[model samples]
Target: MTSRPLRVMECAAGTPGFGAQTGLMAEQNKNIETWRRRLTFRSWHRGTKELDLLFGPFADARLADYDAPALAQYEDLLMAPDPDVYGWIVGFEPPDPAYDTLVLRDVIAFQRTRHA
Candidate 1:
């Protein structure tokens, strides 16, 4: 499939508050799966956040199985048309070691352009 720029908007950041760890893990996993779906040219928006959680580990596991072309295809998707897919990509403050919590830092709005 033709590559396009994706615009990722991180709506929120990971905090040390309640369910923060779980939430960060979920987000990380979900983001990974979202990457897989995007690379495979699947309609990610059609599914729910649960889909994101389910596909996260699956995508990570499949990474080692992907060939060079496939990996390149995935990277291409990240940089295409816009880096943000209606707020798919997110940013948070860095996790704090003292709190034993993951704090997403530098959560900002940005644009990434991918080439074929």
Candidate 2:
């Protein structure tokens, strides 16, 4: 006998399996929100107050708009040593080529706008 094609059902709200999908989506959103909050806290609490001032406002104004790749880039920026990152932002030193990214440029631009 010939094999039959498999059919998949799309689950919309109020339909069977929809609640489970909704619950999973809600859980994923909650986890992302928590991660964002933690990043915001880190941005605001970097050891130096100057770094805090630099990152805190950028995180506050832009963090929520980041999708997964942007979030990953921001997280990577956060993981870099503070002095180096600050130096890059203020043009005292060039950012390591590997770490030079749109996210960093955005932060530098944000800082410029804030102080301009």
Candidate 3:
């Protein structure tokens, strides 16, 4: 079996300027490109399971802008546990102020496991 490294980014809406923020983050983080394929766009209106999985065990912030169906799909992706895939979701703060956006980024890296 192999282990993978993954990275995910979650962006909120109404943050003064969203596109710019994304661009800036992308520029600074070289790993962002590797995980772009696994990006998931979610809305606050959707379920929390997907968000929970991405955010890890300690994600308590509320989402204020998201679509229901989109979130469901995202949740499904997160629940998938494959040794070849490892990922995490970034979280936004001040949930109320942000609306019309919920970005979920995920990355997947693979490493072979050795047997004794």
Query: Where does candidate 3 stray beyond 4 Å?
Result: 1-54, 57-62, 87-116
Residues 1-102 of candidate 1 have per-residue lDDT tens digits of 997765232322343354444666778767666655565443233244533332233344455455445555445433433323223333223223332211
Model 2 TM-score on a 0 to 1 scale: 0.80
Residue runs of model 1 more than 4 Å from their true location after superposition:
1-21, 42-116
User: Could you give the C-alpha RMSD of every candidate to the true structure, in order shown?
Assistant: 20.4, 4.7, 18.8
Best by TM-score: 2
lDDT of 2 by residue, 1-116 (tens): 89775532342645666545466677888888888999999999989999999999999999998876888889999999988998999999999988899999999999999899
Q: Is candidate 1 or candidate 3 better by lDDT?
A: 1
- TM-score head-to-head 2 vs 3, winner: 2
Better of 2 and 3 by lDDT: 2
In terms of TM-score, which candidate is stronger, 1 or 2?
Answer: 2
TM-score per prediction, in order, is: 0.24, 0.80, 0.24
> 1 or 2, which is superior by lDDT?
2
Q: Which lDDT values do the candidates have, in the order given?
A: 0.38, 0.87, 0.34
